[model samples]
Every structure is written in structure tokens, then in C-alpha cells.
Target: MARILIVDDAKFMRVTLSNILQKGDHEIVGEAENGTQAIQLFEELSPDLVTMDITMPEMNGLDALKAIKNKAPQAKIIMCSAMGQQKMVVEAIEAGAKDFIVKPFEESRVLEAINRVLG
Candidate 1:
């Protein structure tokens, strides 16, 4: 299992994702409540992967993804967002996010996405 970083503004989202990934035997290196924190944590922890939310306070996920990719081009990031944000999803992909996971998350889908990214 890969070490993962969960970056999202919502506490419930972080908790939910953490619980789900933990069950897969993944180590959660750390969590970030905002994009800035996410970048900092990434630099420090250098987790194998990161699950970043698109709409976050302080700095958005797309920008943070760019920053992370800039600093670590090999970094793997998956964007998690709600439905109907096609434009943002495209932008996130352009910014170097490996994949996107629609929100109101399903456990199976989330796991599948994680496996795809980690695989």
C-alpha cells in the first residue's frame, strides 16, 4: 500500500477518506486543511500519493497541484470534487492531477481510483 496525504477543507471529508484508505492498509502520512498546508506537508512528508479537493480555502487544489508538480514532477495527485465541475476537472488535469474522483464518494469507486493511481 502507498502512503497517502488527504487534503480537503472539510473535516468530514478528511475523516471519511482517512477511514476508507486506512482499511486498504495505506499509511496516511499527514493531512492538510488547505492548499498551502497541503504543499507544505507534501514537501515535508513526500507521501507516495495525495488526494486533493478541488475547492479549498486559502489556495485551490488546482494551483496546489501545479505547485506540487512543479516541486516534484513525479508526485501523484488525485482530485476529489463534486459533480458538474467538468471545467475544473479539465483544468486540474492540465495542472497535473493524475485523476479525479467525484464527491459524495462511493467506497468502491474511491478504492478503485486509488488503486488505479497507485498501480
Candidate 2:
């Protein structure tokens, strides 16, 4: 199982993702509320993967995705977004995000994206 970092401003979202990941037998290495924390935690935790929310307080997911990629080109990041964030999602993918999961997550899709990215 992969070691993952969950990044989201909403506590419930983080918890939900954490639960799903735990049930999938992946270990949660860290959780960050925004891009700044995500970057720091990424350095400290070096998790195998990161699930990053698109809209956040301090920094958005697309920016964080780019930042993390700058730090570690091989970093595996997956952007999480709500319904109308297609443009940002496309930008994130171009910036080096391995994949993305739409908000109000589906367990199967979440697992599928992670499996494909980590495969």
C-alpha cells in the first residue's frame, strides 16, 4: 500500500479521504489544509502520493501542484476538485498531477486513480 498525504481545507473531506484510503490499506503519512502546509509536509513526510483539494484558503491546488512538482519532479500528485473546476483540473494535469478525483468522491474512482498513479 502507498503512503499518502491528504490536503484539503475542509476537515470532513480530509477525514473522508483518509477513511477511504485506510480501508484500501494505504497508510496516511500526513494531512495539510493548504498548499503551504502541503509543501512542508511533503518535504518532511515524503509520502508516496498526495491528494490535493483544488480550492483552498492560502494556496490553491493547481499552484501547489506546480510547486510540489518544482520541488520533486517525480512527485505523484492527484488533484481533487468540485464540478466546475475543469479548467483548473486540466491545468493541474498539464502541470504534472498524476490524476484527479472529482469532489463528493466515489470510493471506486478514488482507488482507481490512486492505483493507476501508483501502479
Candidate 3:
């Protein structure tokens, strides 16, 4: 099981993803509501992976992803967005995210991305 950090402004989204990850048997090292918190948690927790929401208050996921990658080049991140955020997803991939999952996440897809990134 991977140690994962979840970052999303919405509490519901964070809970949903947490349930899914728990079902998959991954450990949730931390949860953050925005980019700033995410970066700080990442530095402290050093989780194996992160599921990052694209749009958030304070700082956006893309910026946070860049920040985390700068801190740890090998950090594994999966961008999460709603249906219309493909442009940002692409930018995330370019910025070095291992993969992405759309909001209202699918169980199989989320696990798949995790496995692929871990593999």
C-alpha cells in the first residue's frame, strides 16, 4: 500500500477520495485543502503519492504540483479535475504528474493510475 497525500478544497471531495483509497488499502498520510498546505504536508509526510485537485483556493494544483516536484523531483502525483479541465490536466502531465483522474472519480481508474505510477 502506498502512502498518499490528498489535496482538495472541498471536504466532500477529500472524504470521497479517502474512502476510495482506504478501500484500496492505501495509507492516507495527510489531507490538505489548498496548495500551500499540500506543499507543507508533502515535505513533512513524504508520501509515496499525491492525488491533487486542479482548482483550489490559495494556490492551484498545477502550481502546487510544480512546487512539490521542485522539492522532490521523483514525487509521484496524479492530477484530479472536473470534466472541463483537460487543458490543465495536460499542463500537469507536462509538469511531471504521473497521471490524472477526473472528479467524481472512478474506482478502477483511480487504482489503475496508482498502480501505474507505483509500478
Measured by TM-score, the strongest candidate is 2
Which run of 10 residues does model 3 get worst, by summed lDDT? 103-112
lDDT of 1 by residue, 8-114 (tens): 99999999999999988898999999999999999999999999999999999999999999999999999999999889999999888999999888888889999
Worst 10 residues of 2 by lDDT: 58-67
Off by over 4 Å in 1: none
Root-mean-square deviation (CA) per prediction: 0.7, 0.5, 0.6
Cα error, candidate 3, residue 75 (Å): 0.2
The sequence of per-residue lDDT tens digits that candidate 3 reaches over residues 11-76 is 999999999999999999999999999999999999999999999999999999999999899999
Give model 2 RMSD, 1 decimal. Answer: 0.5
Quote the lDDT for 5 in model 1. Answer: 97
Clash counts per candidate, in order, are 0, 0, 0
Q: By the TM-score metric, which is better: model 1 or model 3?
A: 3
Kindly report the root-mean-square deviation of model 3 from the true structure over all alpha carbons. 0.6
| Candidate 3 residue 61 C-alpha distance from true site, Å | 0.3
Error of 1 at 73 (Å): 0.6
lDDT of each: 0.94, 0.95, 0.95
TM-score of 2: 0.98
